[model samples]
Target: MQSYDVRRLSEIAYDADNGVTAELSVVVPLYNYADVVIEALNSVVEQDLTAVSAIVVDDASTDRGGEQAARFLAQHSERFATARVVRHHRNQGLSMARNSGIAWSSEPYLFMLDADNRLRSPALSRLLAALQCSGAAFGYSQLRWFGEEDGIGVADVWDPARLSTGNYIDAMALIRRDALLAAGGYATLADDHGWEDYDLWCRFAELGFDGVFLPELLCEYRVHGASMLRSRTNDHFDALMAEMRLRHPALLCSSVVGVNP
Candidate 1:
């Protein structure tokens, strides 16, 4: 996790006069995906928004992926308003990684881009527009799956009722900074690693916040053997769902427990 100025997550802060200013912050949480992280960075640079910054959170990756991403951002500095890589002292889960990104972010909007995924087109402008005009908490679009899996990911207009069944919205969405902060960001559920996004949305629903769905496919979701969902066990899934239902009783019910996503 080396950078031009590598700082632990605890040490990084948003300095308004530090030459990094933006309307949106793109947070890419890096794990062990060294091979494809550069592609993700490239996609961020290709975004159709100029008043945007990029933050890549390195969760103490064992590989050199974090370093590679930092170097890539440095090499393409002109593409973004500002770009930098932040490091964690140890391997935290995805939720904490995103939380670190949120802490370092100083923008009105935020977008979560997984290290392995890529945007198919210039999406920031359209998603930002949808979020701005609809007065929604966030904006999400249909995802076109690629890699080991090839198809369109399940997507639907924002429906708070459907959240009790399962999460249909992916993490790759443009969200209002204030709304996300008010919801307390993503949660880190013990033994329920991959459901943070669902939990956040459920919290939003409880807070009476909803997202605007854009039907156009704007991003590519990479599915492979290493996907977090693939490694989850049936027992873990049941426990995770039950925990979610318990935590979000207002939005979830006993009938929704053990429901697979």
Candidate 2:
């Protein structure tokens, strides 16, 4: 895939009045997760919010996931009002995939949902309400974990106050599109600390952008064998963290030490 400056793309594409006036733009990036792509797309479509638009970026999936996602969009195009599907010719990392989605979105607020995750009925609505009411640049709800078991377990609530102490916002959370662009999107991380969402949250905090956490469990984050967390590329994650600390000393503290309280 060709490399383009995400910031430049965002500046050129950030037009709030041109497209739908939806309260949220849900961007889902899919790779080879063909088995779950339809379900993920359906989850967003099923949301009760009428003004929401979803943009699914197919990151050059070698499998049928991209085709399946295109079919879903074709069948339920009206439900989302303005649903778009983008494809990359070659496989790019998650960071690039997400950046593409952001560039394609015109909504003021954005939600980053993984292809394996599904949102609860009112998840988008609740998160948007919190952002509106609190005037926070970003907002997220409690995430529930699901798998083979009917209900494996529920994740803990994300406390916005504790955000500075650690990474609280996951990629499945909601954020202001402009704020995300201002923070320079996701950074390329090393093996150990390459979790894209973690790096983004730290950057958000450093920029003085605030996020609100609704206590409601508004989304289900599925963890399967193919999940990125399970892959655990430690070297890449660590290298990313090291670079992040060097780039933003105030946000990450020192490369050797954990986030400062």
Candidate 3:
């Protein structure tokens, strides 16, 4: 993708030299969601948090999803301080693409958003405020399932035990990038893609950074046949669970996984 500087200094946070400085960085890992990626970008642009940057990592898509994303950002360049696209030389998986974006990010807080999903209005501000007030490692927003509209899916308080049995927390969360880096970023799982987010949460628990669940609806999860989570059946779930247990035996089996005190 081509590079361009077309943003005003007043719109973005900056230091003495007017270099790009932001409190949050929204990293979007794009695959082949050309149909809906713009809507996702729109959601990010409409966020209540003004001091934010966006990075789109296109994972060598067969379609022109990356180009479309670049075009959208170019048109709405002023919405964010910095908006750029990263094109992978080859087709890498979601985890690698996300890690690439993470490496490019310099903000203290980060939000990992898939191309298929989007944040609700005012989500970033609310999540950030709650994260600061609660002194938690990350802020998790309650999100509803799109396409299904099966009411709202609310997350409970920081429950590490529940993570062992199931991953109630979706990957759509605002987290301290430093803490995430300290615990290691999202794991690359070949057997089960669904376990990646769960494994990351377990790692956070292992590192003693508890997640704070915000019960308000802050995002919408799009459901479709091409979704990564929907593709995983019950066949590998058991194996994935066993793998998580083996990888983080101390984290899962210990009495301190969810215990805050």
Candidate 4:
């Protein structure tokens, strides 16, 4: 998939020797979620790791969400090793928005946070530690669901064998930049209402990269009617699954379209 040019609004200098060593780039892709984009940015600013950098990609949001995010990040620029607000000239899909952020980041690791979600703890340090020690493609933790849904979203160890069934991990994870780029980043499927993360994980498994799971609730996911999962109808769901099967035939069997997968 092709990526487009983005306008850079705010940028903070990176000073590694002075304790501003940027290792992880928190990529927050914002669409029209103006109301909560700041919350997501705030979570990034609050990360305990001084090595944290941030890239907020505003995908041509009409709701002025991009401006809001730029303002917020500009206010807290000093808190990050490197902070940037990249705005897409037009509205690209979620995958491309993330790709834009990835293109702009200079860090070794990445963490994707939706605009409506927030980090519950100083989880980046722990996730970075796990990834460093395990040499995994990515590291994920349990998520706490809120808003329309309230509960703990559990995660499991990455198992390629289980991919044929369905995606068990969320997009909210700490990932290696090299592994992500090697996988060609997130797929921009025409039928993708969601499941981009699933496609990426399948590619990772195909590349012999595994994910490390940390059993801590480090992030909160807000579920609402406008959320991708809530908007996906049965037909939409089927079409996306069909696309997944076609793209990753080795990872997804016929069972992927069945009720079990």
lDDT of each: 0.80, 0.70, 0.75, 0.80
State the lDDT of candidate 3 residue by residue for 1-261, as single tens digits: 101211110121211212557788888988889999999999999998867889888887888999899888888777777787877777768777777777766788989899999899899999889888988899887778887445566467887766655667878899998887787677777574556777788888877887888888898888778665466676665666667778888757533222110
lDDT of 1 by residue, 141-218 (tens): 999888886888788999989877778888899999888879877888977457888888889989999799999999
* Model 2 poorest ten-residue lDDT run: 9-18
lDDT of 2 by residue, 1-261 (tens): 122554233222111232546868889888888998888888888888977887877877889787788777778766775777777767767887788888876788889888988988888888888888988888877767777433323223444345435454567778887788788877666543326777777677677887787777788877666665455454454565566666667645653433310
Model 3 CA lDDT for position 238: 60
Candidate 2 vs. truth: CA RMSD?
Answer: 4.8
Of the candidates numbered 1 and 3, which has the greater lDDT value?
1
Summarize candidate 4's per-residue lDDT along 30-55 as a digit string, tens digits. Answer: 88999988888888778788667888
Query: Whole-model lDDT, candidate 1?
Result: 0.80
Task: Report the Cα lDDT for candidate 3.
Answer: 0.75
Stretches off by above 4 angstroms in model 1 are: 1-20, 257-261
Off by over 4 Å in 3: 1-20, 253-261
Candidate 4, run of 10 with poorest lDDT: 9-18
Task: Give the range where candidate 1 is weakest over 10 consecutive residues by summed lDDT.
Answer: 1-10
Deviation (Å) of 156 in candidate 2: 6.8
